[model samples]
Target: MSLPYFHHTPETASNFAQNLRENSVEYVRFELPDLAGLSRGKTVPMNHVESYTLNGLNLYGGAVTLDSASIPIQGTGYNEDINFADCLMVPDPDTVSNVPWLANTARVICDTKWYDGRPQPAAPRTVLKNILSLAAQMGYGVKMGHEYEFYVVDAATRKPLYTGQPIFVTSLLHQHPALDKLMRVLNLSGVDMITANGEYGPSQWELNFAAMDGIAAADRAFVFKNTVKEFLHTEGLLATFMTKPYKGLAGSCSHFHISLYELASGRNVFLDAADKDGMSPIMKQFTAGILEHAAAAQAIWNPTPNCYRRIRPHTFAPSNVSWGVEDRSASVRIKASKDKRQHLEVRVPSALSNPYLTAAATIAAGLLGMQHESVLAPERSGLKEADDSFKKLPTEMHESLAALEADTDFIHMLGSEFVHVFQTVKTAEILRLREDIPAAETNEYFDLY
Candidate 1:
């Protein structure tokens, strides 16, 4: 297959636009992620792509600093007073790709800017890029892969796509024509889907991606989720990455498998030869740093109030800050692997997490560990569900926010400006939900507790 048109520089962006014009592509969408990991952006005609690519289009800064419901926090300057102005959206040509399900259209993820060409720190994508920038400066590379367990249901009836006892990794259960179509669309849109299978609940699916660099991996995840939602809708089905969709069924998780490498040597720094379960000193320090800040980082890993509902026992959604060799129930799991494959699996983050912030928080914490040469606690073996003695990670949004508030040093690691806005917005969401509890209360949820 021929290479896609280039977009890494201004000249390349202009050339890419010309290529799109030659192909008669109609509209191009400039996609950006909000704090909720939801796509929000503007669509422009082919004639306007070049101008927007260079000068950028203005958008609501609140698009990056708001609650999951898109409500603006009072202090983020994204409110009615400022009219959510003063931000520019610049498309990354390197991220441009064709939209398989949408007719005559292509899309590119964008970065936010202030009028002065400064990075928009409150932007989740910006937050992540800032961390990646530091890693690049330090001659280190961060790599990650995401595994999202999600559910598909009928659009009209709002239940599982298939009815019957769900089985894990059963080929028969994954034979739906729509799933084949979904996979094709994802691959066509530049998503390298590693593997996919049926999970333990009705209509539930787990899909994995090959490990990629920090920022690019997040972009890949954004496209993966976007394609799944669009393809499911096109197939007359509704799919949700909501952490917990039902009362008794196992909740889905968006787990991240992560590792780091030495940029110069191109070696997987997370592991070493003859290392026990890949538990090198650097790896242990990274795990220690993540564990130390796990409570505070929960503000991003499990951002929404609905997130905590999924942390039930025996579900593989860990509720504690623990590590173990090949233990799926530990919050940070050191997977058993060959020397090159040594890495960690972060189990707490869910499918609905904002990819940018999730990447930002995880990398920031790990870097802090390396900076301080933090020590990993003794590794626990076996599963936590089988034993209830493990120290629990914060299980509630308020608790996580409180931990964030108390850890001023950790908050400073990602910039105080961004952390302050994030905390305020999330806390406001909790208060608003509490106020709505009486009217919104149902069988599954009551009082936003």
Candidate 2:
């Protein structure tokens, strides 16, 4: 297949416009990833797309910084502080693609910027790009692969399509026709899906795509999610990436695999031939960096209150800051430890994490480790929960946010403005949810109190 025609320059934009016309494309959706990893933008008619692609689309300034519920939170500086201004959404031409399900509709991911052309500091995508830029300057390029688990249910009833634990069950994988269709659509949309399976939960499923460069991987993840949700919605089904959708069932996770390659030699920096463990010095230091900031980074990895429910024992989710060679229970699992394909799979992020923010946090933490030349700690074995020696992860959203705020270095690395806005928005979410008393709380305490 030919490479995607980027709409970066006027010549390319013209070519894209001509191609759209030749292909009879009617509408183009300009999408920006918001704080919740949700797509926020406007769809333009084909006639107006070229101009918008060359320039930008004006959107609400708070679009990318809005709360999880997409509400404008005060003090974010993106909203009330700026009197609710407008921002520009410039299409990253490299992200242009056809919207498989929509008739003659195309989609292009965008970067958020101020009306006057300044970068949108709090935009999740922008934060990630800045991190990647720093890594590039440090003489390395990152490769990231995202593995997402989601549950499929009836749209109106909101219940699973099946009723049994079916992890890797072949017949169960085909139980829902939508899964196959979704997979095909994703691949057609350039996701390059490599695997699909039924997960631990009754109707939960995971589909993985091939790894790509840092920005591309995150872009694919963002597209994969929005595409799955949007496509499933049209079929009268709901595909939710919520961390713990069911009370007793397994929680969904968006485990990300990361590796660094020397830009000069294009060699995986994590591999070592002489070392007994095959972990290069750079890899060990990077792992140490991830371990050091695990708590603080959890604010982005598992952003929502519901995310904490997934970090319990025996859930294949890490409850502590731990790392081990090929240990799934550890927060950072080393894969292909003795091979050229060595990489780290960070299991902390919930399915609901913003892809951009997650990538940024992971890269920033590793950069810190490299800067300090930190040594990797002793590895944990077996179920990490059984090991008390490991440091505990924050069990709540507020706690994670507090950890993030306290990590001055991490805060500085990921931009203080972005962190401040993130904290403000998330804290607002926490406080808003606090007012609501759930049935579980009422049932457990009302009569006793």
lDDT for each candidate structure: 0.81, 0.89
For residue 7, give model 1's deviation from the true position in Å: 12
TM-score of each: 0.93, 0.96
Candidate 2, residue 180: lDDT: 86
Residue lDDT tens for model 2, 164-246:
89789999889778888998899878898999889999888999999998688999999999999999998899989999988
Instruction: Please provide, for model 1 over 146-259, each residue's C-alpha lDDT reduced to its tens digit, 9 standing for 90 to 100.
Output: 888889998999978775546664665566788888888888888887787888778888877777886889999888888888788989998899988787887888888888
Candidate 2 error regions (>4 Å): 1-9, 445-449
Enumerate residue pairs that collide in model 2.
Answer: none
Error of 1 at 37 (Å): 0.8
